[model samples]
Target: MVHRIHRIHRIQTLPVTPDKAWDFFSDPCNLARITPPWMDFRIVSGCADHTYPGQIIEYRVRPFPLVRLGWLTEITQARSPVFFVDEQRRGPYAFWHHQHHFAAVENGAAVRMTDLVHWALPWYALPVRALVRRRLRIIFDYRQHALERLLGRAEQGEDACRA
Candidate 1:
């Protein structure tokens, strides 16, 4: 069976500076705030104050009813207040690489945040793309709304979140 790579891209603008956005996102503890309640996501350990290369973060989450999962990711690359990349060391997916980028806009009055994820499922789960896609949509949509509610929304731009 051929393992297929799926991609999700999302862009959001927030009424805050790049520094402020980085301060919140760089801290691993803040992940729970943007995650959906249904996921029951929690940081098990290794949540440092800020992200850096080689940092490991551990998390537990319920991706489906009656199912719990452990997700371990390593911050492979981080450039302060600009971009960071995290790759799953162990998790539900066959592969997971997520990149987060932030830029100052409107003369530093606002921040534009972008998320790009490249992932693939195990061979056994390859046929369930529809189900997986729906789940991902829900999770990302919730994240977008949650961030907006927390940081105040700026004018939204193109959203290319396709799984």
Candidate 2:
């Protein structure tokens, strides 16, 4: 049997339109700004500054201390102001799929952002699932805080979280 791991991040709502939220998250260049610097994550090739359907991205990443791995991912889907999906083609992991979703709040003054990631390492690497899960959370936590600083609240700074 193949083991799979799934993780989801429901980030705090942002006081912005779906289109605004989508624009920031969809831009490939914004990744580095939001990512934690200690990971030493850097884009190696494949339009790291642009994003489009069928776009391929290559990156040099350090998942562990002094451990660097090359990762390649494809933008399988890209729809403006709504969602996008990226899947791993060549990377350290056996499998990886990530979905980014955005929805406007009922009041239309805020947007909700969500990230769902599914991944699996090699068969022999099953023992690292716990560690991987923990690390993922930490990574996402960093992203959440970054977004909050960027578009977390409106200029009015009202509490605009969704109901």
Per lDDT, the best of the predicted structures is 1
Best by TM-score: 1
**Candidate 1 segments exceeding 4 Å error:** 156-160
The digit string of per-residue lDDT tens for model 2 on 1-163 reads 3467655545457888887888788777788777888888888877544467899888888888988889899999988888899999998778888988887885778887777777778788788878877887788778777887887654442332210
Model 1 C-alpha lDDT per residue in residues 1-163, reported as the tens digit of each score? 3388888989888899999999999999999999998899999998999999999999999988998999999999999999999999998889899999999888899998999999889898888877887899899999999998999888755545554
- Cand. 1 TM to true fold: 0.95
What candidate 2 gets wrong by more than 4 Å, as runs, is 48-50, 153-163
How far is each candidate from the true structure, as Cα RMSD in Å? 1.5, 3.8
Separately for all candidates shown, the number of backbone clashes (residues 3 or more apart, or on different chains) is 0, 0
